[model samples]
Target: MGWLALDEGYEISLVEGKVAVRRPEGRQLKALPKALRDHPEVDRLRRLAEWLERHEAACAAQVDTWMVSSLPVPTELLARVWPDGAWQAALRDLAVVPDDDPDEVGFLRDATPGGELKVVNLDGETVRLSPRTVTLPHPVLLPDLDDVREFAAELDITQRVEQIHRPTWAKPADLEPAATEVRDYAGGVFPTRFGLAARATGLGYRVSGGYATCKVRDSGRAVEAAVWIGEPYWDDETATGALNWHDEDGRAVRLGEVGPVAWSEGMRMAAALYAGRRIEEGGDEA
Candidate 1:
């Protein structure tokens, strides 16, 4: 099931489908310092430690699929459990298994375009296949069995995947005015490096100043106009200073500043590069 990081103690969801602070034997932690145990924050840490330890053991025993929330666990605990550095790899194999399967699972294989490939939890409904590896939903890290069961009921589990895109990192492109104006006229928001590449490739829009400028064409005719987008950074305080959109002549043509946006343009640009796309411009500008 899911291990929720509570304010004081870690809540471990066990096989019986119930959340408990102690282990399966019902032995509660009684020796913890009163101050540390009572403190809401410290209590949370203790619970997380216990959760980690138990799950670590389970995984060591070769159990499959552990679901964890977005909260990052301490590196020490991760290392202790994963001495061989195969936790992530092991976990990937164990996701999306059926309810009847035990907590610990083994590798399963099937034929693919590249020949026979093995993945954790071959019996799982969702088989995420990639060129080099396969992945399944981690059971421990899942929100809860009920949630997963509900999900399975709603979604088909027998679908075989053809591809999985791994993440990558890349530098942002020097954008041109044509691209910037196209982004602006398209009523753009969160103009990420990836978005810029997409717009230039005719998949996304362009933006410039507040009003729309760039127009989309269909069959050599205009269809939709572009608009200026907000800043591309994650926070507002860092939005100052105009960014120079470059052109082919190596001169700056469009100018803009980082504005309030949720996602970072750099991250988006990196994702696009990971997807094997290129971003080009004419020159740079202020």
Candidate 2:
């Protein structure tokens, strides 16, 4: 953005998402000048930067929701939002499959004003696709995930919203039908329950009822995966507990009944919580 002239032959502009000051001679200063420290323009620019940051975060979150749920996104909507920097950043480089033809998978590259999409196919060719709707399938649902990852790597693709490279855990075939919880990520110790809960929330999971929970929509059904983090008032030492899933009605869901998205997300949350556990000496997890 261009610098705006202030009252004292000083120019101010946002640089690297911060207010930067420059002398009239065009020399930039390391810090904001003392005279203009309380300028209204500076405060306004700071607020604008804050709003931009929030907008970027919100755009990425919405894109993640669409990918995680494997929902079909309209090309028209994509085209409309393509001009926005935040939206474009969130949408670019995502692996998209046409709703009508799932085999036509490509990395999104551009969205035209006429609602046409330009993508890079697996053949190392830039192709134009005009699908009415496209799905950014979750990594767990991508049949050719390995191929896609390899292709993305070759293209030097990096997505603001995690999709292709997101960690995933698949449900085992030999699981007991009646089992309702997974103990793989259990026993992760933390100094305090508050610390464990903070870690879960910091990772974008919700803290409710003494559990760190993630809700996902899989196969048109709403399922919530929860990992016990201990009671809210438990200030002493705490440990992460088993991960479990429940249906929309709050009934416990058996391990075999959990959908692929729900299961993967559940395990992902559990693993993330466990990864933040306090480490003991010798580089061992506590």
Return the top candidate by lDDT.
Answer: 2
> Candidate 1's residue-wise lDDT over 1-286, tens digit each?
4544444444333333222454344554434434344656545555766776666555533421112111223323333433332343343322322333334233333324333333443244434233322223333233344554444444433322110111212223564324332221121223354344344345222444322122212122222322222344323211112222333343533323211110122223223322332223562211
* Shift of residue 8 alpha carbon in model 1, Å: 16
lDDT of 2 at 169: 91
Best by TM-score: 2
lDDT score of model 2? 0.93
Off by over 4 Å in 1: 1-286
lDDT of 1: 0.32
- The CA lDDT of each predicted structure is 0.32, 0.93
Instruction: State residue 256's C-alpha deviation in candidate 1, in Å.
Output: 23
Kindly list the per-residue Cα lDDT of model 2 for residues 64-178, writing each as its tens digit: 9998888889999999999999999999999999877788889999999999999998898999988899998899998878888998999999999999899999889999979
Model 2 weakest 10-residue run by lDDT: 277-286
